[model samples]
Target: MSSAPTPSRSVIHGDALEWLAAHPGTPGASLLTSLPDKAELGLPIERWRPFFQQAASLCLQAVDEEGLCVFFQTDNREQGRWVSKAGLVLAAAAELGVPLLWHKIVLRRPAGSRSMGRPGYSHLLAFSARATVPAEASSPDVLPELGELPWSHGMGLAAAEESLRTIRRASPSTRLLLAPFCGHGTALEVANRHGLDALGIERNRKRAERARGDR
Candidate 1:
């Protein structure tokens, strides 16, 4: 009997960055997309702190463990201390020999452009991981539901396809993990379109049971 080859530890941490810093070669994901139109720093900035907190905590922790780390953000705000966070995250990753993938997922909703009976939000996944390959070509994270993120809850420009393409071109070997509701599965498909391995993970016990019953 042949044993299954162990997949490299592609640590896909979900809301667990605090503990993932110790793990080697774990890339990070950005949640923020962009600042609201006419948005300015101040109270709104308070909300962004959590983003920095999570990134800082993970980076610092990674340093202590002599592990590698990456900081990925989606917020497109180039003002205030956001740039500082990027510098700090990059510095920490460099010190620990960790690579970071920082890319933006662009979206575009042209009123009648969305699918799934929802406002059509074109998915454009982007990021950069300082690993062997570019982080642009990534697979799905949660099956057809990449990231397991509900379509209703998905946020972004919904039309950043162009930006995503740029990221893919920058790094053509990165795999994208996706889920069933994986942000239109565009990123996974994008990676696949670009000759990258795209993977999907889904928590579909209920659906699987229903399918078996029907069968």
Candidate 2:
């Protein structure tokens, strides 16, 4: 951890897999990321399984025994059937010895505003190298604060912030929040706003510049 290169706000512009391979951290550091969906990326559904499988392995390797990962994903309609992308991640994590600690629903859809053929909610799944404590004593499994949000690459800022709060409660000593697929630094902004150190990695130069508040 001490040997890992640090960037401003700990955010670096590079591949997350490559970064994680070199800078694994201890239990006090956690990852809160809203990954790009296969639909959003224009990738086939079949490709996501292996991709997330590899990602889960990398994430589990990067964190310590108690370090947790909060993955934000939404269910989508694929060729007339509903598919849970989070489910794929769950299986991937399980294969790598990480267990699902909690599954939170971000109720982003308001009454009558639901999109046709899509679920009305998104999921925030928390995982840890070790078994995660039950979330019943802390935050509820359904988050109602996500009624409205600023959207970027299909993720909302307020929603991401609220989700991070849940993870913080679970990992109170966590000092840094890392977003591997940071599109416009939404998670990074939210983490910094809460007085936590945040790191973002984006391969897109334009979005990365926007995240840094540069013109």
Candidate 3:
């Protein structure tokens, strides 16, 4: 019986935007990340929107042309209005001339359930500058539920798995996963388990250390 190859993980403690700008278009790298919400950044909605757009643009730009950039985001209600992170990401991708490869909805709560602040579903969107997914290679458009979350704002295990599966199919040459704003290393851990090297950039020192998974 053959064994799976061990993967490597490198967690950097610094601003994601700075890192992305400094290392754009990384070869053999794809992205799977969840951008931080306004609350986490301690910024007003007005300020956070631009920040989110810029972060999304950088993420899309950081990957190789043949690589995919996936985002896991949930919609939230702010000041009696719905704020859609998916919409924001779509706009960013549009500006960059990237095409949407797929958009899957992952249930945060059971179907037909109601929520107060965030919706009952989260968006799993993939974009690529040149990669294309054929109709025969399509996966589920909607996920039944988010498997397990490592933190309150981390990517779910099932979602991460699905994203990586899509990447494996769409971009077979992808050897690394880049995660910016990695909360608790949920995606990083999942990436390693899937035999892909993972690199994460986080602004919070404590969270960055935790993302390293050394202890």
The TM-scores of all predictions, comma-separated, are 0.33, 0.82, 0.96
The total of clashing pairs for model 1 equals: 44
lDDT of model 1 at position 182 = 28
Off by over 4 Å in 2: 1-8, 111-114, 130-137, 145-148, 152-154
Instruction: Estimate candidate 1's alpha-carbon lDDT, on a 0 to 1 scale.
Output: 0.33
Once superposed on the true structure, which residue ranges of model 3 sit more than 4 Å away at CA?
1-5
lDDT of 2 by residue, 1-215 (tens): 46634423755777777877787764467787777667655778788656766765676667656667878787778788888777777877877767777788887666457576667778888887663565464767777646435453546665677667765666677777777877778778777776677777777787777666574
Model 3, residue 38: C-alpha shift (Å) = 0.3
Best lDDT among the predictions, by candidate number:
3
Sorted by TM-score (best first), the order is: 3, 2, 1
**Candidate 3: tens digits of C-alpha lDDT, residues 61-80:** 99989999999999889988
How far in Å is the alpha carbon of 184 misplaced in model 1? 6.4
Cα lDDT tens digits, model 1, 1-215, are 99744322122213334233444233332111211111322446557556555445453342212112222233333443223344434454466444444333223343435244322222322233332333545544211212423233332222323333444444333333222212233334433444434332222343223212222
Alpha-carbon shift of residue 145 in model 2 (angstroms):
4.3
Each model's lDDT comes to 0.33, 0.71, 0.93
- Model 3 has an lDDT value of 0.93
